[model samples]
Target: MQIVNKAVVFESGHEEYAVPIQSVISIEKVNFINPIPHMPLYMRGVTKAREDLIPVIDFESVLYNRSLAGEEARLLVVQTESLQIGLLVKDAKEIIDIPQEALKQMGIAAYEKTKYFIGVAAFSDRLITIIDPDILVSSLEGIKDIQEYMKQNKLFPA
Candidate 1:
C-alpha cells in the first residue's frame, strides 16, 4: 500500500485538467454570477457559495478561448495559501490517486502559459494536465484587479 497524490479532475476545452484534492474546498452547483464592468474576459464575475463570495474563473475562456456553457457548468471551489476562487469548468468528473511515478515534468515551451502546469499524468485511456491553483490564479493578467474588486465590493474578504 502507498500514499499517493490525489487530484480532482475536471473538463475544460474538451480536455481534462486537475488540481490537488487537498486544495479543493467544494464542488457546487453553478449559481448566478453578478458581473463586473471592466473585468478581464476570463473572469465571469462573482458568485455566492458555501456562505461566501468568490470570483469565478471562466476556465474555457482562460484556457480555450471559448465561452463557457453556464447552464451545464460546475463551480469547482479551490483555495490556495491565502486566496480562494471558483473555477467554472465544463464538467467535474472524479478524484483519483496518482502514483509518484506517473507524474512527469512539464517541458513544453511553445504554449507560453505553462506557469500553472505542474506536470502531466497519463492513465490508460486519458492524459491529464495537473495544475497548481496558486500559480494558475496568479498567472492571470487581471487577477489582481479581479481580487481587488471582490474585496472592495464586499464580495470577498480582503
Candidate 2:
C-alpha cells in the first residue's frame, strides 16, 4: 500500500498550486482588506476573521509578479508554526489525494530560488506546484519587518 497526501488545490493567475490540506484552516471569499502602510505589494492587507486579524498576501503577486485582477478571488487561511495568514488565490479548487510517488522533489538550486515551492505534482494533464505554507509565510519580502511593525502598532499580539 502507498501513502497518499491530500492537498488543497488553488489557482493563482494561470498557474496552479497546492498546499498540504493539513495546513489549511479554512477558505473564505475575498472581503474588505484594510491596507497597511509601508508593506510590500504582495501583502494585500489584514482582514478580520473571527476574532483574529489575519494578514493576507496576494499569492499571484508573490508567485507570478502580477496583481490578481478580479472580484472572484478567494482566501485560503493557512497556519504555520508561528502565524496564521491568508493566501489570496484566484480560485479554490477541489481537494485531491495525491500519491507520495507523484511528488517530484526539485533540485537544491531550484529549491533555494523558489523557497515557497516544495515540488511539482503531475496530475492528469496539469502540473500543480506544491507550496510549503511555512516557507511561503516566512519567505515573503519584508515579512519580518512588517510583522514587527504590526506588533509595534498593536495590530498583532507581540
lDDT of 2 by residue, 1-158 (tens): 21229999999877888889999999888878898887899988899776688888998888778878587788899998768888889888789888877887756425554777777788678888888888777777788977787788787787
Worst 10 residues of 1 by lDDT: 105-114
**What residue pairs clash in candidate 2, if any at all?**
none
Clashes of each: 0, 0
User: What lDDT score is found at residue 118 in candidate 1?
Assistant: 78
What C-alpha lDDT values do all the predictions have? 0.84, 0.81
Candidate 1 residue 97 C-alpha distance from true site, Å: 0.8
lDDT of 1 at 146: 80
Clashing pairs in 1: none
Candidate 2 C-alpha error for residue 51, in Å: 2.6
Instruction: Write one digit per residue (lDDT tens) for candidate 1, span 70-93.
Output: 566999999986579999997788
